[model samples]
Target: MQILLLGGHGKVALHLTPLLLKRGWNVTSVIRNPDHESEILALGKGLKGNLNVLLSSLADVKSAADAQKIIDTVSPDYVVWSAGAGGKGGPSATIAIDQEAAKHFMTASFASPGVSKFLMVSYLGSRKKQPSWMSDSEWAGVVKVNTEILPTYAKAKQEADEYLTALAEVRKRDPNASRFQAINLRPGTLTDEPATRMVDLGITPKGRGSVTREDVAIVADLLLARSDTEGWIDLVNGEEGVEGAVERVAREKVDAVVGEDVEGMVKRFFPEAGLKF
Candidate 1:
């Protein structure tokens, strides 16, 4: 399999590269800096996958047409949007790379003939409204970060996710559209801890928590292999094994929610839970 991985220099993407390579899948990693080419190539040194570095910046991709041109050249079977502005270029930069570039690539993917699967590494709290089950204190903290700390970054991710969800819906109704599947792997606060290979993956919120970058990479690899898994997934460090958690979530269909509705969403996953809201 061939995969086009955006944000090749990212922490998560770097960790994910080896897993894909070990599977003998060819990966074309797109990076803005040419210096990082050797670093990315080094990951596939002993692996079977072919590594190709595309010297391009996501900021330059302004339109769907521009993104489509890159897609046409790569002709990848899967696309991973792991790139972000990282707050270096300010709010406008965040919107340009995170929101606009992401949407453009996704839109381009819908038209690309070879692209079938698109994976987005997003934040677990990337939503317009807080979940109903979240405590007031927790929600307040999240609001502070979203409004004061990283407001632009949060908004960019939220908008990008919404755009992807809308595109998935449109594709579902249009039979003539290219056959595609999109997975929004929303991981909680990311940490540089070691890989535990254990996580809580589901549609419902798993409260505020931190997940290891390695574990997130593992989950991304697993999700890519499972063709039946699509839609948004909430991920965090938990007791369940990554493989089992992914299998269970993939077997059971859970609808993604944007509002603060808890009862309906919870009951769908845990029908016997008689807890009162």
Candidate 2:
């Protein structure tokens, strides 16, 4: 498959690009500078020829148009956005990259009549919750860094997901809507370890187990192979020799839990299969 990797220099994309190459998929890595462009190429090492590198600032105004042009030119089978801008100015930067950039890229790709799929990565826990990031005080870095503005990275992600969902719905209503399918993969606190595959790392204040970048890539590739996928879905690594039961639930079950229940569930499953959102 022909694929585009947005923010291709990010850690996840670093691992993601190589794995995609192993699956025999051609990749176009997008970055902000020529130096970053060369660095990624160098990292490809032996897998060199399988990758195409591009340089552009997704934070700029023209990014949307430029991104759209690239999409039209390559006409990729899939687009993976694994880039993130966090810390201090992270809120503003994230708003531009995660939300504006996401919209531009999604609109650019999905707006076409023949585009295949749009897969993005977002945080898992807050998918269904409001931007309680500032309120919680638990996720202290985001708010304190920006101080007055209280950068809302979580809110940016949430808004972006909602926008894509709406766009997909609108596309379906029109008989001649775009053919592209979109799905957001919301993985838990990402880790570099390959050992924790398919397990949910209790996403809480204290944090829990870790989900590796390799695992998230596995889920993204799976969705890209299919034409039908949507909304926000959770993907994690399940432990070996541990065939535990993990089921999907309705929104009602989420609302059924009390505040304390959340903490208890989080602590209990932190060491086990991980907690549920």
Candidate 3:
């Protein structure tokens, strides 16, 4: 599969690109800084994979038209919306990069041909039950650090996630209306620790949680290969191993077909096989 990742220099994307490459998938990362090109290319060193780069910044994209130009030019099979303004950028910058640019990407994806999948690496708090980041206390400490921009970043993510949900609803209501498919993975407090390669996922997974950036990339890879999976899945570190977790789900009995059919899809990167949507 071919994947285009925005915010290619981010911690998660940097780890993700290499993994996808090892799996024999093509990866193209869109980045704002030309200087970071070497770092991104370095991930593929001695690895068998194709890595491409596109020079673009969400900050410079004024509207959906600007975003469309990039999507049209790349024409990737899948798009991963991972870009953000980071801590240095102020409120306006946060809104521009996180909220407005995300909206533009969604609009562009709907219009672009050959771009059927969108995988978003969102936060655990970005959901309908709690839309804005300010509404959640997880960011209380960050607010004190960058008083002007921290809260704004949360609000920006909230709005962007809402926009994605609305568009997803449109697709669900009229499957034939659009060929695009989107899934948002909302992971709990991200840490820089080594990956556990295991995750507990659902609309709501019990217990306090955290997940490694490397593990999040693995989940992204699994989801990308699964053509039948869609919608939001709350993620957190879990007891089961990464491959084990996916295997368990694939083995669950469903009325649609015999055991072998489900196993075939799961072994080949399909999830929730033989289950109703």
Candidate 4:
């Protein structure tokens, strides 16, 4: 299989690319600097396979053409968008690179022949305003959780998530359209430890689980391997001492804070009754 990675220079992508190479997958990394072209090529030769890099940058939305060009050449089986610069930025910079650039990548994936998998690195708090995630002041906490790059990054991720969800639904209705499978892989906090087991996705992280980049590589493999139609998969890392994982821990934390969805938290707080959304 061929995988085209955007922001291959990213921390997580660095680990993921090598993992894919080991699995005999061809990789074409997209980056803004032509300088990175040689870097990924060298990394590929080190791993042993046809690893290529295309020059592109997500910083400027106008350069979206660069992304399209790379997509045209690679025609990969999966397109992973890890494209973003980390650091403090206001909402404007956030939306430019995070939201709009993401849109460009997804659009290109749709255009790619035979490409069906579109995976993105997203956070859990992305949908706090929606009934599906939470209600009340819980939203403020969610905001902090998702806003790794602060408000700007959070806004961008939120917009991108909603947009992709809508796009997936449209395709689901149109069978003639490509049968695309998109997933948001949510890891608590990125770490650097090597993966020793399959991800514990059944539970939320136990107190902000931090996963190593190696662990991220494992989760990415699981994500790319699964062919789930359209849904969100939260792979919160960390264990409660021996047995329980984050998901199990989440039930306790959420229940302690405001209780479960069974308590009518959805209707009581952010009611969808009056407004036609």
Model 3, 236-267: lDDT tens per residue? Answer: 88877777655444344111111113223233
User: How accurate locally is residue 189 in candidate 4, as Cα lDDT from 0 to 100?
Assistant: 69
Report the error of model 4 at residue 47, Å.
3.8
lDDT of each: 0.85, 0.61, 0.71, 0.63
Among these predictions, the greatest lDDT belongs to 1
Q: How far does residue 167 in candidate 2 sit from its true spot (Å)? A: 1.1
Off by over 4 Å in 3: 128-150, 205-208, 246-277
Clashing pairs in 3: none
Query: Which stretches of model 1 miss by more than 4 angstroms?
Result: 258-277
Worst 10 residues of 2 by lDDT: 249-258
Residue 211 of model 2, lDDT score: 70
Summarize candidate 4's per-residue lDDT along 106-144 as a digit string, tens digits.
Answer: 767766667888988876555544333344455555656
Candidate ordering by lDDT (highest first): 1, 3, 4, 2
* Predicted candidate 2 versus true structure: per-residue lDDT over 60-120, tens digit per residue: 7345576778787667778888876754355677788777888788777765555667778
Candidate 4, number of clashes: 11
Q: Estimate TM-scores for all models.
A: 0.90, 0.70, 0.79, 0.75
What is the TM-score of candidate 4? Answer: 0.75
lDDT of 3 at 214: 89
